[model samples]
Target: MSSLLDLHPMTRRSLLGGLAATGALVVLHPFAARAASNQAHLRLMETTDIHVNLMPYDYYADKPNDTLGLSRTASLIDGIRAEATNSMLIDNGDLLQGSPMGDYMAYKKGMKAGDLHPVMKAMNVLGYDCGTLGNHEFNYGLDFMFNTLAAAKHPIVCANLTKGQLASDPKNDELFFKPFVIIEKKIKDGAGHESPVKVGFIGFVPPQIMVWDAKNLEGKAQTRDIVEAARAWVPVMKEQGADIVIALSHSGIDAKGPSEKMENASLYLAGVEGIDAIFTGHQHLVFPGPKTWDGMQGVDAVKGTLMGKPAVMAGFWGSHMGLIDLLLEKDGKSWKIVDFTSEARPIYHRDEAKKIIADTKDKPEVVAAVQEEHEATLAYVRTPVGKTSAPLYSYFALVADDPSVQIVSNAQLWYIKDMLKETQYKDYPVLSAAAPFKAGGRGGADYYTDVPAGDIAIKNVSDLYLYPNTVQAVLITGAQVKNWLEMSAGMFNQIKPGSKDADLLNLDFPSYNYDVIDGVTYEIDLSEPAKYDKDGKEANPQANRIKNLSFNGKPIDPQQKFVVVTNNYRAGGGGKFPEIAGDKVIFVGPDTNRDVIVRYIISQGTINPSADGNWRFAALPGTTAVFQTGPKGRPFASKVIGAKIEDAGDGTEGFAKYRLIL
Candidate 1:
């Protein structure tokens, strides 16, 4: 084939003679040649961790959100696709469960065997070629996962998951889409010869599914590490005729390595021989786009040469799409990528003239559909569940035992008791626990889910419970339980107790989600440093801010055993909590904590959702109060005992102020 196309060293006269024979080619000259020179370029666009931003949907506002909709992304995708020589659209996962649409689509409306779930429905319309699964995919269990996947027109490829009863069965029919797929395309060579290129994509998720969603996976199947499975299969794909291999990882890129391979797998995965590029997500933080993974400063972990190979992890929740462009040199039997550029498709960009409109726009249909669902959800979410006799608050979460967290624990235990009726783990005494995922900083003063005398809408419930974390139970010793609280004490920045009011904590330490425990009583002595991490390493054992830990009105015994129930995020190593390790896990929940709360509310017919009031700070009597407030919450918060807004700023997020008045 080469012999037929090769041009031997020839005389100028011979070249002229050949060119004259093709008069049109001679006339076109460099104009035609320049276009050919740019032909091999392939622009790859990736959308990762788009947990239901189908329309310009916003769960917080409980309304038709116009800012964050995927429809806004459509215009960008269209413009990029129009300018590219060849391109492939891939979503990186967690498409099914974040907003009200997901909840409405899941347990409420319930998808039919062939019906497209709203997210899947919107994705199908967008025409995705490939995608992977974020851990959230299993939140609703396998049957529901498959039903949602079955609605997809694309391949749902992940190399690490086991389907049904077999780990290796081809018949497992695992995903709503294929686990990996290859796209064949043609590009013009330098001399106008048509060259065929095969771009292969392999998707992966963190293997911690065993801990994150154990109840859903325990009897159904298993999951393997992303790197190990990807390494084994990339070579197989090359053998099957792939030219360039890209990993669409639903994992994230992190600073601290080792344990969180899923978070920073790309760094090490870059060394994997057959891979050329990687697209990643799952941590919800964007990369190479104004973010840091731990101590590493300016690390474009999302865009880096991991082991000499290119990789990028897009930010989560449709915030950014990862883009990587590679130039390949045809090296006989294979194509070796010679140069590449990795970047995030930022939602907004300034033009050469320094103007900024939306760098993208919403897909009209996607916007319309998700908007319709968003409104319906709002109407449904607002209907009150019950009346609250008093306001619930989170200001004292980590510093003391919190009733806000206590409510979650009660709901989980309640849900577990009923779910266990027919399950094998029924005999165990279950205790539920949950940390606030969204307390204040992001949501402002109103962000704290304290409801005042009225019907509590589901939208309000979301603030009470953000994130769709399933109920997980870990079998822990009494000692480990105490250690968990010690780690939580990290939320407090130790100020020498009498040091004239040293700011001992990040006031913005999110209250609802970070609040510690409910089942036991303990005190955080303002004098100690946090025992654990910003990284999940061995926590300092001597660190002790918590004092007089007791359960059931007595000092707890370390030998006592109990199933510590919590969410998938915490159980799967989210906040570096102790005792929730994989070995100690007895059950991974398929039911979400929010769902449990909702169900518990329904069961009681009237929810007395009050804090157990198990813990409290000694007293802030001497310390001068300090906190800011937004226009919406300043008055109410200032009136509350020992609380006062000392300063304030308009919250860029819209309603609450970045208050600091103490």
Candidate 2:
């Protein structure tokens, strides 16, 4: 383990001043009076949702990106450590599986007993004190996850993950990893006297992992509810002499009160006793910032607290580092927190011209740790698979039908139709549902998928299907299908009649949740409010946004049955879509959606991926709307099939605004 002084030379000066102020030298002189205070400052830093972004590069775009990478965040670690007397760096999970580098490691390189995963190698260089498990860590299966974690130099803990069946009592369950770890450190108080402080770290992963990665975890593992596990184990930590406890919640902050297996339970977990602070993630959002979680009940965004407990959530892909500064005073036999501050510090920021500017350079040691694997991942993603006749992009996916989503829907329909040919469902009408994974929201303007008319590579296919979910076919009636589409219509905000330049998209809704079902033509009525809210709950039972629904130029009958091809996540209820669940699933394919897409592209030597104008927004005279997209989407504005797009101007956060004529 590297000492704070060794990592940053300036920390020595800062430590001396901090120790003198704390009264650490009182023992050296018996006659000297004790210093004024016995308080010590401890800084806790975190990196969450790294997703194997060790280098400052985007594998899908095959270019350098200044906004991401742990190497860039590592550059700030030394400077941050220098500002504190005692500091501990930890990770808040989602470190494994997101980029092409993770795929190259899991599917190609393969981990062995002693082989260090590229992410672990890079993280080990920074000396993470501890880390928790994120839902993405289980994407590659348990064998690979455990093997990769075996090489981590620091302790990794998760209280909710269990092996086999869950026991009635959360404490009696067979835990897969240590529930918590108490790190003992020597600290100097105001009198320059060395004293011991026991800092406890407990971690919780979202229980939704069982549904998201059902193929990998069913029958082999189970998960307890996050708050239940925290409530059960936090007291044990205190009983074991843990003076201060920090919860590494790999969950998002939701204002909704506690429920069974809630995906976002950080707000509820913060209310648990004995937890001094919290490090939150799994939403890929930043706290103490104005983007998300602002104005939500129980969330103090300005103070970075949940239920009055200090908390921090770093943005995804190493975009920001979550920081928590604590002022601790020794209270007889135990230490208690007196005051605290929290922040999510970014590695880069946008300039006045909306150009990304990096705040720090990449750390040489962290980059060197994963250089070999980084090069191999580049080679792996660059391998050509097939060619496309037209360009594929998702810049206008939210406002119109898109080729990027069209290609995926076409591939899924092609594969599922052939798959059901020999089965009993062969005669059933087949439809495919697909969504744009990247639509330039919280991921930033450069995050949109843009592939030119040329050869398609593995990277492009991976960009189209961002998850490792397998293909699934669900059986449903026409009425249920309409309800499904109704749920997806929540992506847009309701526009009033005759309203000019109204905001089109519902920014709160995630792009991945906006499913576009193919093989059926329909129009989204913007004049009506969405029947469902973002959580799939019925917000307006009387609302109807879907209109002119037809299967083959005829109105779909309510009793008619159809098989919808989708990914395992949706079929298994990963997203809270109505009438879609495991019971409706008729077939679960063995291959991943990404693999199916690759195969589909290869089989069709050359393909033309163009939107067929199947779905469009209902025309409303005297009503116009506007939305923002990547600046690079200007040239392809005419390609959008449904609406008339006009240049509005430059938008905030490097996005270009466009007006939609309805």
Best by TM-score: 2
Q: Which candidate achieves the best lDDT against the true structure?
A: 2
Q: Per-residue error at 35 for model 1, in Å?
A: 8.1
| Residue 610, candidate 1: C-alpha displacement in angstroms | 2.2
Q: Model 2, stretches more than 4 Å misplaced?
A: 1-36, 385-404, 410-455, 461-517, 522-548, 552-662
lDDT accuracy of residue 342 in candidate 1: 67
- 192-284, model 1: which lDDT tens digit per residue? 566778889998877766655677887776676667777678888888899999888877654445443354465666567888888777665
TM-scores for candidates 1 onward, in order: 0.66, 0.68
Q: Rate residue 106 of model 1 by lDDT.
A: 74
User: Candidate 1: worst 10 consecutive residues by lDDT?
Assistant: 1-10
What RMSD does each model have against the real structure?
A: 11.9, 10.5
Error of 2 at 19 (Å): 24
Per-residue alpha-carbon lDDT of model 2 for 1-662, expressed as tens digits?
A: 11101110122322332233333421221111222257777789999988888899878667898878999878777766665667899999988787779878987788877888989899889999999999889978999999999989999999999998888888899999999999997776656677889999999998877766777998999999999999999999999999899999999888857789888899999999989999998766788776456567889998999999999988877887788888778899778888788877777665566567666678899989899999998998897768999999999998888999999998999988877876689899999999999889999999988889989897788578766567889999999999999998999999998999999999998889899999999999999999999888999999989999998999989899999999877887766899899789887664467767876887897888999988999999999999999999999998789779999999999999999999
